[model samples]
Target: MENKQLLEIAEQAKENAYVPYSNFHVGAALITKSGKVYTGCNIECASYGGTNCAERTAIFKAVSEGDKDIEAIAIASDNSSKNEITAPCGICRQVIAEFALDIKIILGYSKGDIKEFKIKDLLPHSFTGNDLI
Candidate 1:
């Protein structure tokens, strides 16, 4: 799907975020190489560390659907006042790196700001499943 469409999906996903802890709602959308799109929102847990990020949730959902080869991802957050729109975290990056290194990542903000980059751009020289070989 087009980045614009993916951004729309991410925005919709954000509405489903269950973030009572930090109150930072985030959403993610992943498009598979075969043209299927999957979306997810951040789910926060009282345990803090048990929280799951929108990026990982979307990626996991895509993988579970047998979309092992991801093409692109978009992340959106309405909490732009406190933080700028950015890519996935180290853990999410590594998880994405496992399935896709050349995947495109679209970071979106509430104020109409947007950023785009390949997954490799966020995690340069990252250790992936290839590292196990």
Candidate 2:
């Protein structure tokens, strides 16, 4: 799927975000190499450390279904002011690198506003399984 389509899916997923604390709603859409799309929304918890980010949620869902090769991923975060394009958090980036180091990452804003980057661009010299080998 195109980046625009993935952004749309992420936007739709944002509506289900359970963020009563920070009120930061985030959504993510991940496309596997096989062309299957999985969407996820941020889920907050009473214990701040227990919160799960949208990107990881989507990635975990895909992984749980036995989809390991992610071709691309789109992330959208909605804010009260200008919805600036936001990249995935540190942990999310690491998790993404674990799956696909060269995956395309699309940071999305309103609708058409987006910025694309390779996973390596976002997380250079990332620690991956190769480090353990």
* Model 2 lDDT-worst window of ten: 77-86
In order of appearance, the predictions have TM-scores of 0.91, 0.94
Candidate 2 error regions (>4 Å): 80-83
lDDT of each: 0.84, 0.88
**Superposition error at 52 for model 1 (Å):** 0.4
Find the candidate with the highest lDDT and give its number: 2
Residue-wise lDDT of candidate 1 within 63-117, one digit each (tens)? 7877788998989887543447756888888888888789899887534666789
lDDT of 1 at 116: 86
Weakest 10 consecutive residues, lDDT, candidate 1?
78-87
Residue 56's lDDT in candidate 2 = 94
Error of 1 at 132 (Å): 1.3
Once fitted onto the true fold, the runs of candidate 1 whose alpha carbons sit more than 4 angstroms away are 80-83, 109-111
How far does residue 14 in candidate 1 sit from its true spot (Å)? 0.6
